[model samples]
Target: MFPKIHALCAAAACAVAASPAALAQQTLPAITITADPRADRGALTVPDTEQAIADIERIPGGVEVVPDTQFKNTPAQTVKDILERVPGVFAQPRYGDDARVSIRGSGLSRNYGNRGINMSMDGIPINTSDGLVDLFEIDPTAYRYVEVYKGANALRYGANSLGGAINFVTPTGRDAAPFEGRLDIGSFGYRKAQASTGAAGGPWDYFLTASAQSVDGYRDHSDGKEQRASGNLGYRFSADAETRFYLNLNRIRQRLPGEVTKDAALNTPQAADAEFERLDQQRNIDSLRLANKTMLRFGPATLEFGLFGVHRHVMHPIYQWLDYRVQDYGGFVRATDRRMIGGFHNEFAAGVKVHNGAIDTDQYINLTGGHKGNLAASMYDTSKNLSAYFENSFFIRPDLALVAGGQFQHAVREREDRYLSDGDQSGRRRYDNFSPKIGVLWDLDPDWQAYANISRSAEAPTFDANTFATPTSSDIEAQTATTYEVGTRGRRPGFTWDVSLYHARIENELQCLTTAPWSPCTIVNAGRTVHQGIELGAEFAVLESALATGDRVWFNANYAYNDFRFDGDPVYGDNRLPGVPVHILRAEVLYKLPGGFYAGPNVEWMPKSYYVDNANTETVDPYALLNFRVGLAPAKQGWTGYIEGRNLTDRRYIANAAAAGVATPASALFNPGSGRSIYAGARYTW
Candidate 1:
């Protein structure tokens, strides 16, 4: 099915490329349009946060921008903490920074690190060459804002993964405060200190931040500490060209708390497995990254290109002792022409990127903690990726446009076994995929827009996903999907909403099959599956009475209705794939008190229990959590403070579960959520 459709798209793209109309249009008179590249949407803008949100509303599809202020004044701990209340995003933390963050059911089968999702730092890919990405490298407070490109909307960022991409944009010296400092103390022995400085002189500018944090965690054997520093220096060559260099360094040391059974997870939620406690397993990392981005504008056209390098060292002791040193390098180039063509409005963008890396990896028997017994396995692993993509939108009218885009990706994975004493698992795999997308955006008026699109996405199995215990059965098939979606976004009379409905037909979903205890799981090419859902985000000015000139009450909400199931699989036979709940909702209500004081209550509710495995033999019950926060706005005074309370009801519930093929109900699969906690933070600005 995909082959035929892809062929059609390829032919159409060729035709469009050679069309006389397009050629003539491009040869037309070129007019230059220039403006500041900063996120600020000058003139027609409100506050910074509002401007960010407004930018998202202008996109034709599912996309969003989260303001830094939303979490900076609060206890910004982990990805889960940073992405709360964002619909279509499921970020559930089990321990420390290990969270299950999936969008649109992508990476639902992985209980560990992320996959099927592309992550970026200032538009640079954050995933390893083989798709091994660590959330701990992401400092929740380091970003000025976060941009979410859902699914195919990620074309601009060079991502074609099923889960799309997330870009963390940092603040620069242009408008940042000269100096800022913040301190946070919270329950579970949590504490952090952060400071940042920004300066600009002539054509040179720099922004830098340093942060240190530690947490005792809510569970036994779970403790962690991290130190991070990030900086960027920029130089402007005249007004039409600019270049920036970035540097980031991070060091993290975190313990591991093995999973517990359902009963234990709900009862003794704070207990760790006896084996994990004795081993004192830990995951530690030291990493350094450098990157650059350059943008040049020329008469209604722009060119952007960049290069990046990352060096990371990891020492982990869990099921086995592991050590790794990885070096990754990449570069990209993109060009955009937004001028009118053939007297009609047209926008075209094209780009290509290449990323390659190798890792020196070794595994040893865990003698307990950091001690290694003997060489168990050793290998040199390498991964390479190359992608070419293009997008062009033709305005059919002044208020509507038709968009076409696609990406071609080639990926290679290879392993060289050095430990023949155990077994020679050396092999290689190559994968190629062509993902294409088409859509239409129509303006209903000046304040509203409607859009519909269909796209194809593919995912190659990652090294972690191919960790087969049996070397003979190491080949895992890639996953593919065809998705159909429609959505709308608009604002009217103090109200804003973004909603979308989507359905996907998926083939060869990669699934984990744990056949033995104390052994690494193997990946399988699971049969057909279907993913369907609705995503809704809304904000309402509930109380804007004129009587209270300065007081206002606003409510914000995000909800997702997910229905994922097997599509006539031989074993599961239409049973729902386990892990994600049927309904997830997050909401908040805030009242502004004229004096720069604001208070809000937030709720995260999963109204339905979900199965834990393919067999659906066991389930996790529904849960609801309430949290409250009161804070003084940063603009209110030189010194501002906030107090936040989480899980006020202290409800016991499972936060995440590990899935097996169809194991016994007694398997250790559950991880408990954190208990009641309180955090207070203060910031000083000059």
Candidate 2:
């Protein structure tokens, strides 16, 4: 089916490219940025490469952007599926909808909550100071594009700058138009529906979108349902200045299919039976964001300023797993000034941020004879940061350009925790740190560039680790990393590619320790670790025709090699990082057909290593998977349908590993991936 789809799409793309009408429609008008609405009138079109370069130049380190065109028509189910195709990025799915993301060797020690990286949507930080970002709260359908900035490049966002940053940007009223809707259904009882509408009248423009999705799931106890709504209201004072307000709401109801043992995972990756009563989990999140951006022309310089705030609330029902509630409110103000000085173009930016939040969590412990012990934990944390940064680009002999920049930041954090057990309260803890970064880029020519940078980043300790009066103290020091990276991006007539190499050394990393076999796990501060790797990615146009109506064929691939290990004495041996796959590779080929048909085939491969059990036992082997998709558009501006198959080989495997011997000894240490599944869906756009 996938091969047929690809052949169809390839034929369509070639036919369109060859058609005189299609060639005529391919020409786009230039866009102008201005302060007057009248002056902003024109077709707003910009190449993906231009935006990618702009992001790279503005950031202090490595950065990558994935355009909407890359995944809009793919058979991907979640953001993890999209990101996994990118080199140096990996998603670790615990069970069903829960997943943890890691980049360039970072997030190796984080067991429960998000750590080492910052995630944001439209400039609102999704990661709490305690180092956790709930990936389940995000829906990929809402965003027009995704951007990833690695190492020090994330400094502009906030702390936890070491691993990197991910930003999801939604489409505006002007980009998506008046109304749009889509419905999708796939294998395993999967179904999704989404709709959005927007109107632009004079100076005011409003947009709203809603979505609902459900799946029977690949494994038992993994089935789930989700609903989400988002809105954006903006007032354009002028073309150069605008104020926008955003609101996001999400609810997820799911069942926890506890982890299985290595044997179970390997033998029955799609099994749903549970030894104990199945646990049900539900999560709710409501977030509001307001931001204002203004651009001003000052003599030979352009000045831009932005101010924004966010409010987030989360509730869950899994005490031992993660039954907690939190409220976060914060604001940031930043200004960037760009000007030409002494034949060099210089850009300077400075900002200050304040974050204050409170979290209350409860833990239940099962005692003998079905008795239960309840523990209540509460915490208050506040963080303030001040930073100043500058970057300069000098054009040397037209064909060659040099870019350089630096940043200085000062941060302070304070925390206090109270525990109900023993009616004890932990004293307030205070911490402060200073971090810096520097980088340089050289454009060898129009199609080639070389860049290198070394930056420092840090992450604060979380409340659970700090408040619980366990033998292992939670007063862990902040973790820091110094990373050096070199990379390049370019394109030829029929091919494009990007590659990078990086090395990082971290201090005082946080490692979670679980009680062997019968006991639960806890968070702890480990000594030191080192992460180094190489990433290579590229895309090529395999076939093209100008005489046909719409016929084209393309291939895309990504590969990464990661080498991670302990740098100093730590509780655990210098074992290869548990979840970080040493080698990851992905490739796909897509084609468009003349009759508006499309098809594609994609493959993902990962070499596995030791799977750690609660008793520290190891499960060793490797895994590979394949997927295929086929689709057709009955009319140019009407209905489109698709059919997709996942795990075509029906190979069974484990997606996660943890200690689970005592409770469900036979299946306590593994979480299986999925099996071969088929799905079909259709959409109508007007």
Candidate 3:
């Protein structure tokens, strides 16, 4: 089936390439950066994060960027899929769109919530006061670019923590244009509509966007819907100074029918059992953000400062059995200075942040005598954190640069738990650490560069990890790591490629341990781990031929290899990292035909391995799948249509796994990736 689909797509692309209209559109345009907060000479070309990326790559670490064009090509539904395509980055999705991301083996023990990685949108931190972010709450369509800085390079953000940082940047008024909107409907009763408009008049500029999406889900009992709105307003005070205000709000409602057994997941990926009727769950997340940024020019130097605040609320009822509520509020401020010293240019950035939050939960059980009662298990945690960091990138020579930075963080966490008629259990913890990074970049030539660096970072425990009493410590101490890396990037006439290799050693690594009964467990920092890997990515215009009607053809591919493991640990016993695939490869060949016709076929392969279930039992498997798409658009004013088919092979495979000793016997939460599904849609843009 895969081969047949590939062949059909290939033939159609070939025919389109041979048409007369495609030849006129064969010439590819240079990429542009559209997400920067400041408007300057470089705004039309290099991205604001480009300097950040260069500094990170040169630091003894690894980093990657997924531009807007690359993300759009895949039609990504979630941030997880976007990260998986980046070299050396892994995303473990235990359920729909809820992801646990790890880079350089920094977040191996994150099972139930986000840890290690620090995620942010437009410079506003996303992690709760307890140091976790629910990735599902993010709307992928809202961001124009994503910057992933791994290892010590993340020190600039005061996130000297493990797993590094991910910055999602939204479009500014200048990039979005006057007005635009999109509407799409697809399989599983999926529907989505979004619109944005921005205008610049005099010294004031404003942009606003709203979007909504709903899906019946691929499996029984799993349906979801979401709505989001965001706006930005900026004013220029002077020729070189401007201030911008931002606002964002989101709401999500979902139903969890419950997980299926392994056999059921494999045999009937689309079927829902009758017993699932009794299972019901819903989650709601509401978030509000406000921020301001200003840029000032003094002499030959440019000074920038930003202040922001975030408030998030989570209300959830799981299985009608467990109810949970959480609220988080936080704020931060950052400042940076860019200037030329003597013959060298330098950029220095620093910031401080703090957060406070609380969580409360209740559990219920069905009594054997047909009686049902709820048990109160309430907990309150207050956390205050402060970090100050400075990063400087100095151009020692026209083609040579040196980068160095460090951060000092002070964090305190206090928690109190109250059980039904039981005395309160209270704990308080404090942590202070200094993280530093240094790197060098030698631009050997115009299109080629060599870089190297070494850096130190840390990761804190999550709320789940904080629940434990002993051995877990109060804050799980900070998980620390040292990373050494080198890499290169270049672009030739028809080829563009980037590759890097890194080695990292982590101490006090976090891992989950299951007790004998397997009904309850705790997270602890009890082990050491090592990660080494090579990431290679490239795109080549395999075939660029002009045919009738201005058609063109091209093919591209990317691959990544990761070697991660526990360093002679007693408990894990030579087990591979649970969610990180040793190898990942993606390839596609596309052609633009005349008369607005396009077609392509792509393949993604992951050789899987075993993962410890919630009960500490191992489950093993390996799988492969293929996908294809073709679309047509009549040459008209503003109307276009497209048809896409995913998982063309209809292969049955698990998309994610649960924590050790979490699921019942014979019950593994095997969230299957979508099967051979098809979607057709149309849009009108003016």
- Top candidate on lDDT is 1
Leading candidate by TM-score:
1
TM-scores of the candidates are 0.92, 0.84, 0.85
> Which residue ranges in model 2 land beyond 4 Å of their true spot?
1-53, 57-61, 271-313, 319-323, 362-425, 468-472, 516-520, 544-550, 568-574, 594-596, 608-620, 633-637, 658-669
Residues 19-85, model 3: lDDT tens digits: 2232223221111111223346222111343333433344434566554434433334567656766
lDDT of 2 by residue, 101-173 (tens): 7788565544444566778877667666455677777777776667777777776665445677887766666
- Which of candidates 2 and 3 is the stronger one according to TM-score? 3
List residue ranges in candidate 3 displaced over 4 A.
1-37, 41-61, 73-75, 92-96, 257-261, 271-279, 319-327, 360-375, 468-475, 512-521, 546-551, 593-597, 608-610, 613-617, 631-641, 661-669
Quote the lDDT for 413 in model 3: 73
Task: Give one digit per residue, the lDDT tens place, for model 1 in 230-317.
Answer: 9888887856677889999999999988777888899899998777877778889999999999877776677889999999999988
Clashes of each: 0, 40, 23
In order, the Cα lDDT scores of the candidates are 0.77, 0.59, 0.62
For residue 489, what is the lDDT in candidate 2?
62
Worst lDDT 10-window in candidate 2: 1-10
Model 1 scores a C-alpha lDDT of: 0.77
Give the range of the ten consecutive residues with the poorest summed lDDT in model 3: 1-10
lDDT of 2 at 478: 72
